[model samples]
Target: MEERVKIIEERSLSEGWFNLKEVIYDYTWFNGRVQRQSREVAKKGNYAGILLYNKEKRTVILTRQFRMPSYLNDTSDGFIVEACAGMLDDDAPEECAKREALEETGFKVKNIEKAFEAYTSPGTLSELAHLYVGAYEDDMKVSKGGGADEDEDIEVLEISFTQALEMIKTGEIKDAKTIMLLQYAQINELLN
Candidate 1:
């Protein structure tokens, strides 16, 4: 088969914390017809997320924070429960996950198990997320993590693994990365 997509033009629409571009391309159909298509894509780059679990306590450390996008969409207050995550920002995915874990949840994660990588929203966003699971203990608390400086206002929560799983069904845990990690823990019996 021949190459499917051919880029015609790409124009930047916005460039700030992230870049947004409008692209025109030619896509070859399965029937051998070429179709011109245009799409606007937001390029926020890749990120890493970690789910911190404590085997002895059968608990997980999570964070809740106000998310502008989620607030503008479906959430009334815009606060969401999610795993510790941050942009890779030139660092390795595992390192980013570890840093975010400590900065957002006060847990200094040491051994991270790479679970999987996924595109959060492939249709219009160019963000690939690296996922990880890390074991934590009570002694791992290193700081009163509420994010660094004035960049984030995060509330850390330590909840039982069973309750966290139940939150998934109750619509309390809506973040995709968090959901995936919780499911991974269940399937792998990480706490047991």
Candidate 2:
């Protein structure tokens, strides 16, 4: 497939917060036809997310925060329940996951198991997300974590696993990474 895709040109469209680039490329179809196409891609760097679970309590720690994109797209309040996550930004995926977990939920997660890495939106956005499941105990909470900075008005919630799963059915908990991790825990019987 590498031989089938030839990038003819690339131009930077924007470079604030994230990068946007317009790329012109030639693709050779399976039927031996060459097609030229142009596409604009949003380049947000890779990220890491971790689901924190307390087995003894049968609970999961999640965060709720206002997301402008969700609000702009029809989420009534724009708040989403999600796992702790952040950009990798010069840190290893595991380290980034741990950091985000602590910063967002105040849990110093120690036993983290890597689940998988995925492209959140491969069609137009360049973001690869590393997913993990982390175990925590009551003693792990070191602070009242609502995010590190004032701008991040995050609310941490500790809810039973069953309740969280029900939220999925009730049209809540719509964050993709959070849903994936929750389903992974259920399928793997991690809390059991």
- C-alpha lDDT score of every prediction, in listed order: 0.93, 0.93
TM-score, predicted candidate 2 vs. hidden true structure? 0.96
The candidate that wins on TM-score is 1
Model 2 poorest ten-residue lDDT run? 68-77
Structural similarity to truth (TM-score) of each candidate: 0.97, 0.96
**What residue pairs are clashing in model 1?**
none
Candidate 2: tens digits of C-alpha lDDT, residues 1-192: 449999999999999977999999999999889999999999899999999998899999999999988999865589999999999989999999999998999999887999999887799899999999998999999988899877899999999999999999998989989999999999999888
Model 1: CA > 4 A from native: none
lDDT of 1 by residue, 24-53 (tens): 999999999999999999989799999999
